[model samples]
Each structure stands twice: as structure tokens, then as C-alpha cells.
Target: MRARRTPEPYLWLLFSGGGVVAALLLPVLVLIFGVLAPLGVIEPPPAARVRALLDPLLVRLALAAVVGLCLFHAAHRIRFTVEEMTRGGRLDVVLAPLCYGAALTGTVIAVLVLF
Candidate 1:
């Protein structure tokens, strides 16, 4: 009999990609936009400039992708961490759907907001 395909690998790929993107992009983003800008260590972009930056379809898509992947990474981490912490072998049955469902929902919201 042929073995049925499992989604675990695909999910892990997303988790890994998300982690990398979050690690690489998020800190710099926070540093520039959240910390330095607010503390006046760096001048923030003007509102019109920000709007201009977001005017490109590619920029919006990239932003949406980053948000979506990060959400997926978070979901995967939360699911496995909770499962491990509880030492409950059966938790995967309940956790996977909830975690991934939330990620999917967030991705949808990001797309809608971006577009």
C-alpha cells in the first residue's frame, strides 16, 4: 500500500522560514521603527513617504508574507511548547488545528489589510 502524505514536513518548512524571517527582519524593523523613531534617535519617515513605500504591489505582498510566516512560526512554537510543557502525548490531536487555524486566520487578515 502507498503511504499517505503527511503535512508535518511542510509545516516545519513554514516554521523554519518564519523563524528565519522573524529573526532577520523583525529586530531591525523594531529597532528603526519602534525604538529609534519613537525615542528620536532617528527621524521617522514622513506619513506620505511611508504611504509611497507601501504603494507598490510587491511591497504589500512582501509585508503580507512576512506577517503570515511569522504568525505560522508563532503558532508552531506555541503548539509544540505547550504540548511539551504539559508532557501530554495526546495534545497534538487538539493543538495542531487550533494553532494552524489561528495562523491561517491571521494570514487572511493580513492579506485583506494589505490589499
Candidate 2:
């Protein structure tokens, strides 16, 4: 028996969407536990150790990578959405470079912020 291979475009869509959902939700969850609960107004959740997240160098690299990849992922997803809505003409030409350019800019900003 042979396994089926999914198309690359669909796979990228799924991965990008999932990553966005996770990234968005995580901050909310963190705020709920880290700040809200600590104020004693909301029910408190158990604390989890985040020692690794506290390292400045590691944090900067991680933030930079996250920002860059996320922007690229977002660009692809948004471009597709725009394509569906507008339906044609030079979309790829305009969007592809913009996406890459934004990602590169984010990477440079991250490097500056980190350093």
C-alpha cells in the first residue's frame, strides 16, 4: 500500500493557519494566567516554569524567527484570500516580493532589537 501525498499549497495553508491560531491564542492564554490570575480577581492557574523564555539572547532569536516566519506565512495566506476576493491580474507579482521584503525587514529589525 502506498501513502497519499498532499499538495504542497494545501499543506502550507494548513501549517500557516495552524501556526497563526497557536500564536494568537498563546498570548491570550499567557495573559490570562500570567497577569489576570495573578491579580487574584480571576481563578488562578498553576504556574509553569518559563526559565528558557527569560534568556535575552534566546528570546531575541526566537522573536526574530517567529516574526519573520509569521509575516511570510501571513503574506501567503492573505494573498490567497485576496485572490479569491479580487480574482486575478498581477497579484502574485505584487504580493510575492512584498511578502519576502516584509520578512527580510522583520529579520533585520529583529537583529537590531536583539543586538
Candidate 3:
């Protein structure tokens, strides 16, 4: 018998990684930028300071990863949900690529915008 290879492991890895990144960082970002800064619970940094903070290439790469991973996390969740709803029928074949493709597209766009 020959060993069979599948892409499932890689997809699952991305899903797990994205989940960790989203759980660890998304809430903090949302709380700080979305809630605190907007409500003035914390003063927002000046535009120049924000620009300077994001000026470095490393910072941009980090931001891109966060954004891209979050997108992949969402895509994974949605793909499974859709598959379950469809009872893992033929629709799965269609949904898999669509969901992941959207994530990949968003990641590419983020890379372009960030870089």
C-alpha cells in the first residue's frame, strides 16, 4: 500500500493557528481601538504617532499576519458550518474552496495594503 497524502492537515493547521491568533489578539485590539479609544476611556494616539508605530516593516508583517489569520479563522468556521448545514454533501466540494479562497484573497489584499 502507498501512503496517501491529503491537504486536510494543512487546512486544519491554518484553522488552529488562526483560532489561537484570533483568541489571543483580536479581543485586545477590539477593546482598545474599538471601545476604549472611541469612548474616550483611553485617549487615542495622534495620527503621527499611529503612523510612526506602523512605520516599520516588521510591524506591517505582524499586522498582515493578524489580519490574514483572523480571516482564515472565520473562513474555517464558516466552511464547517456550511458543510454541517448541507450534511457534508456535494456542497462541501464547492464550499471548501470558496471559503478558503475568500480567506486567501483577503490575506493577499492585506499583504498588498500593508506592504
lDDT of 2 by residue, 1-115 (tens): 7878745565376448647755876588668877888888787744443444535677767666666666666666676677678885468778666755776687688778666
Error of 2 at 77 (Å): 1.0
Which whole-number lDDT from 0 to 100 does residue 25 have in model 3?
A: 92
lDDT winner between 2 and 3, please give it.
3
Predictions in order: lDDT = 0.95, 0.66, 0.89
| Candidate 1 residue lDDT tens string, 8-43 | 899999999999999999999999999999999988
| Cα lDDT for residue 35, candidate 2 | 84
lDDT of 3 by residue, 40-105 (tens): 999898899889989999999999998888888899889888888868857878898999999999
Clashing pairs in 2: none
Tell how far residue 73 is off in model 1, in angstroms.
1.1
- Sort the predicted structures by TM-score, highest score first: 1, 3, 2
Best by lDDT: 1
Model 2: weakest 10-residue lDDT segment is: 45-54
The C-alpha stretches of model 3 lying farther than 4 A from their native spots are: 1-3, 86-88
TM-score of predicted model 3?
0.88
Pick the winner on TM-score between candidates 1 and 2.
Answer: 1
